[model samples]
Target chain A: MAVHQRQTVPQAADRLMPSGAAHHEQVVARQRRGRIWAIVFQAAMLAGIVALCALLLNILNQSFGYVAIVNTIDPAELAVDGVPLNELPKENLVEILEANISAGLMRRYEHDIPFAERSRENVHDLILERVVEPQVQATWGLFDSIFARDSVFAEADERFPGSDVYFRSWLTTSFISKSQSSEPLRAGVRTAIFGSLWVVAITILFSFPIGVGAAIYLEEYAHKERLLNRLIQTNINNLAGVPSIIYGMLGLAIFVRILELFTSGAFLGIGDQSTANGRTIISAGLTLGLLILPLIIINGQEAIRAVPNSLRQAGFGLGATHWQVIWHHVLPSAMPGVLTGTILAVSRAIGETAPLVVVGASTFIALDPSGPFSKFTVLPIQIYQWTSRPQDEFRNLAAAAILVLLILLLSLNASAVLLRNRFDRSRAIA
Target chain B: MSRSAPIAQAAISAESMQGPVAGAESTSESVLGGGPPLDLSRKPRVAESLIQGFLFLCGAISILTTLGIVYVLGRESLLFFANEEVNLLKFFGGTEWQPAIGRFGIWPLVTATFMASLIAMAVALPMGLCIAIYLSEYAPQRTRSVLKPILEVLAGIPTVVYGYFALTFMTPLLRGIFGRDIVEIYNTASAGIVIGILVIPLVSSMSEDALSAVPNALRQASYGLGATRLETAVRIVLPAALSGVAAAFIVAISRAIGETMIVAIAAGAGPNFTFSPFRAAETMTGHIVRISGGDLSYDSIDYNSIFAIGLLLFLLTLSLNVLSQWIVRRFREEYE
Candidate 1:
């Protein structure tokens, strides 16, 4: 054994030592390749960061810039009692709307939503949308607007005679307060915001309790060896990966068609009978709820499973029932985690567009969503419609809307991260 | 250890064992004064049964939802087939997709969908692998925490916004590179590129999880053998995580296939069976949106056609998901 070890030691030493300059060069070449690859990996990561920054910068660039707007009916022609149109009173704006729009359109507007009950600001918005119909003739990017302001104004004047050039930030307080319009200058995301809020609320209400319950049943109650339990578990994992648009088709067929009476608010007896249909907030909400259900259930299951089994055993050893132990001991510990999951699910619901589009989200709706039964659109759909328009101004509006969506999503995710950290701290302490 | 002291002490006490029942009895006696204590045990039985039933029902809802999806899609697809004009052979084999003129050929849409997915994969796969390798092997913990969240922010950005970015920025950039005549205003290349960007975070996050799951011993052994970090990552870690990386690829492809807004807004609303990425084309999701967005009569052929397309899409994505889940399960079993 000593002789064998001596021979092996010499052979190992020989293998470790480089035999010549050629071997040393080969090792150096390999090391250089490794360094190149490391640099490539770092560059790939930087590319991801660059892509994100470019997206945000591009959207922001379009959201605020110099725009050349030409009004269809010159504001000078609509002066009341020698007051310029821009400086006129609210009542005069209402008068201008009534005078300019067709009688049929005026009647339809009143029928859809009473003109008299509408606030002065609403009337002003209507006048701006229908009467003036300001069309964007030219747009310059933010860089051009800032660095070449004089050149931009000069170009606008040369291209669009008698047009007004203004640096407009499409995202404003009014942009969040007013409803949609055919004219980009007057359009706002108020209705879409409300629609998104209502839909997300319903999604939470429907998915949360059920998701938590499902998680509890799966994690604490169901026997792991049972086939039914295994099937249910597998089904859920598969569902989490299903493309969201399929859920929309399900909504269209079931919520919008088979159960139209309920979704259209006919059963509730509250929606507008003339215009109300199954393409309402309820269908969209339910569809989104379905889309996020698997996500919530899966996340909740993970949270519940993470709770220490010893806690449950302690409750059971104290003569507590299974349900009692779960309620008092397991749920409290899992609450923060469950809430984080819910927040994430809701964020996903808020950003989802494909399913809502399939569920027949309206492209243009001025009326606010009064209830679950009302026809509605959401922020993503609004952004989509605006982006598709031929006008450059609508693209600006799309960018502004995108900013609002990004803020909403980031805030929700940030809260989720905070909640998760809190959970982690509590767990560490325990 | 100190925080668990009280709980551990409570577990050893006899009073704690009878804690719930005794407390309930005392509270009941005080409230009723002269009356007998309430049957706390019996009371919880009824409530326990009800809660258990409720939880079971909630679990059933997921199953019910799956059933509902299947039933609804099946019903509508059957109705679509019941129409005399929809020939099964022609629907699958035909190359043209002019549904407006009563041509129900689906291959054109399928080709467009696959073409876009392929382009998206070409951009996403390598970038995602490199990012994953960097995050798992090279990046420090602090950098990982910061960069991972930032990458997720890219994932969370709504697809519609990506659509706008593609149409406004990427398309113009591509136009400048490829010239106006070659790059159509609404070409698949721009949409596919943005979709790839959207998918990068998904792929990177998933592949990083896979790469990090590789045992540290493997990496250390390679290092001990005089292997460089990059060589160890590329030669040893990647091979071990191959199944997981493949699963990520499949899932990302499924996502790309189902992506709607980017294609709908940027890839023009025309189904064309072409090999060129520079041409404007319509994908399956795009076609569904276009038809559904328009005003069609309730029972019209166009309405039924969308259901058929949805069924096809559903099946495709479902199979992909199932395959990915299978691969993941197999990988987990092999590793753990």
Candidate 2:
């Protein structure tokens, strides 16, 4: 019995030792594999952050750089009575514009905004664009401008002997205030900004009320069991996924063609009959309104649905009608969420170029939109047009425009976030 | 509560007393004298009906918009097909695309669109999956919150800006990597890369939702079987969330197909039927924009062609979106 026990104990020991060791090794190997995968995942996240940084860096590099400006007619030469062109009187600047450009162009400009009523600053800009006609002979990106300043200057001097080399930010205050020009130095985004504002304003006017109303009906009034209601709900969900360019096509077919009279202001007798057609701000707005309508409706429904059922029940107990309960309690509580959605939708609308392009936003228009009926150019189209140009300076201008657009979009989103946060905090306290 | 109850009762009594006087003053004197007291509540009911009607009208507009889109696309596409100058057989089967000289072949645009979309998917799918896996399985709450919004910011940046980035930055980088001769100035590769970057947020967000929706018990079971985190994530979690991942991929592909500004600005204007990503090519959306942006006269064949292209694009994206929705609905895992 003692000999049998001894042999069994040794055999048990031998079995346990190898198996335990193998288990330990397997766990270690798995841990190593896990660590590797964790690194890979982290690397992917890092790539996203890096890509974002690169995009911003690239835009910044293009927006501000060393530019060699060589005017066709020197500002000093154009100075009248010892007054430099930069400091020239409004009258002198106007005279220069009238003298240089064609009579037809001058007449059109005057007719569009009236030269007599023009601001002094406006006349100054006109002189810079039409008279001086400053051309960028060479440009260096932000990196080269700073690190290789001497080399850039040398190259500029070698290429454009008389040109003045300066580090310029294309996004000056004047950039937003001045009008577009063939000359990159004179090009600005004033008309485009105004057009964008007009389109966005109209988009909001059309979309917000309709979107919210649809949400109210779908969430509070429509019975889920009803086939019609289910169909409407399904349609809304699908509409949200429809490509934006399709909306542009719809705008082209309907607003630009079928509804031309109303959109072109011919019916209202308000627009320039000759140049103005259905491709106007109103059409673009309505198209974008359609583009974002589904987004707003879906978001609005979500916000309304998020309102607790207890609140509705309590209102009913107080003898409040269904409509009254929704109007008074549901809407108020859902407002922050609704506004958040609207802000997102508006941001999307502002950044949208596809639908607007399809809706026939002008690629270049110096004149600001007079009203909804006027032909318009938005910021995206302006940037697109500039980027398509061959000159390096136009790319710089496009970069600057991108910065403006980003800032505008980010601020709008940030404000919405802040507002939502405040609302959430207030609600939590209550 | 007791103290406020008496005040509420008094206010109600006062309101009831004043209600009759207000009603009598507001209503016609003859009706007030002879007929039963006016049903004041009926006024609110009438307003309620009016409001309901308006809201219902608003709801109907969305459905109308869908109908409008279908009608417009169909009507114009029919016009395009009816024109004798545009041959339907050549449009479907031919490789060449020269609209100016009267060749209306569409294969070039379709091929370019497919090439760019394929390139975009190649970059976006794996990276997006990695991001989703990390966010769902690895990231702490704080990191997720910080990272998610930043990714959304990437989504929010204007597509025109991405176009510019592709033109100036991505193209130059590609030229540096593959000798200048290989990569054209307006190659599809750069645009495809930028587009991939643009869609990363979309793919990652959708996939993360899918991964997060996976039941924790499956993960726990895998762990109980002595599986590592990587093994569990790849073998168990990913398989369980396969439909969701596929849906995200399909949706991203649709978005890439419909994307306009990037391709319009960065991809070359000419429609080349080449399968090479490094060459200049135009997509269907790009072709539509380029033609429509020009001064094409009404009733001209060129004008009609854009609508035809638009119709094709619409069908492609619509089918993809519907498929994605169907997949999500059909295969979604519901864990109690």
Score each candidate by Cα lDDT: 0.85, 0.86
Error of 1 at A204 (Å): 1.0
Cα displacement (Å) at residue A32, model 2? 2.0
lDDT for A235 (candidate 2): 90
- For candidate 2, the docking band is acceptable
**Weakest lDDT window of 10 consecutive positions for candidate 2 chain B:** B17-26
Q: Which stretches of candidate 1 lie over 4 Å from their true place?
A: A1-12, A71-134, B1-44, B331-336
In model 2, which runs have C-alpha deviations exceeding 4 angstroms? A1-24, A73-132, B1-44
**Residue pairs whose backbone atoms clash in candidate 2:** none
lDDT of 1 by residue, B1-336 (tens): 133322333343332332133333323233333466455444547767788889888888889889988898788788888887778987998899886676778988998898889889999999999999999999999999899989988888888888999999999999999999999998899999989999999999999999999999899898887788888999999999988898999999999999998999999988998878999999999998988888856778888888889889989998998898888777752544
Error of 1 at B107 (Å): 0.9
